[model samples]
Target: MATATYPPPPPFYRLYKDYNENPKSIPEHPPPIEGTYMCFSGNYTTDDVLPSLEEQGVRQLYPKEPNVDFKKELGSLNRELQLHILELADVLVERPSQYARRVEDISLVFKNLHHLLNSLRPHQARATLIHVLELQTQRRKQAVDDIKSGEKSCRNFSWSLSEP
Candidate 1:
């Protein structure tokens, strides 16, 4: 194969050389290159950067699901919670020493449950708030009872309460 040679590269004129050579070559006012800076700097409008929740096929928690029954769902969740609490109580009855460790797990489960409840129905977020209040009341009662019975120290009984 014969060796191929490329032609000389085009010359790059100094600042405004072309403009000086031919004043009319460059328009007095060039059209703005829309978003040229933004494109170069990786900056994009909200629509360009992130697809809306609706566009992403994410159904809105509220009005989108018109057929959703909030009362029924909440009732079911309440039942499940009752069952879990009963199970946790049974575990505590079986092993009194496991209170501290078991309570942490129960707290985490409730946190997730509260998140689910809020996400499913923002209008019904009050349910989670009420539930959290109930939990706090229950925990406070338990702590007081433990303190009265001298089973656990009031000083050592540290409860992390979250307001939903």
Candidate 2:
């Protein structure tokens, strides 16, 4: 297999086309890392340079965030979506043109539900891995048992033939 270049050049390497083309005129100091507090920008988006973030609304989590019951939350959202859809149906039937807010509510519910499901992806992957391992273990045990049974039958046949 071909070896990949170690510590491949940063994404911004292309920006330094001149230096790459002529290797000797390197700058006096290496370029600062992308997110460093430089030039009065004060590391605008880096977590360390800013106060604690209080981001609002729905956001996904990886490997399942602690203390949140994904199953219950999903159930609640499912119910909420069902309710919104029912409300939308009523509005469509009674006042066909006045369903905008109901549609918006349904859209919001769907977006939240999607975000919640995405947060469950890591959890689902782990669960699937565990189930696959369990099946593999069961198959191994069954194979071992079958081999043992076959060994017993072979020994029984050899003894009977020897006695004859």
Candidate 2 segments whose C-alpha is farther than 4 A from its true place: 1-66
Against the hidden true structure, what lDDT does model 2 obtain? 0.73
State model 1's lDDT: 0.61
Point out the worst 10-residue segment of candidate 1 by lDDT.
Answer: 155-164
lDDT of 1 by residue, 10-126 (tens): 564443567867887753566756553576668655332333346644433323354657566556656756776887798788987767756765564465455446556645577
Q: Name the best candidate (by TM-score).
A: 2
lDDT winner among the candidates?
2
Which regions in candidate 1 have their CA more than 4 angstroms from the true location?
1-68, 99-105, 120-164
* TM-score of each predicted structure versus truth: 0.28, 0.58
**Residue 30, model 1, lDDT:** 64
**RMSD (CA, angstroms), candidate 1:** 25.2
Give the number of colliding residue pairs in candidate 2: 0
Question: Each prediction's Cα lDDT score?
Answer: 0.61, 0.73
Candidate 2 residues 1-164, lDDT tens each?
A: 98888878898666567885787655467865565465576545333331111243534322245577778888887888899899999999999898999998887777777766775677788999999999999999999999999999999999999994
Task: Look at candidate 1 and give me any clashing residue pairs.
Answer: none
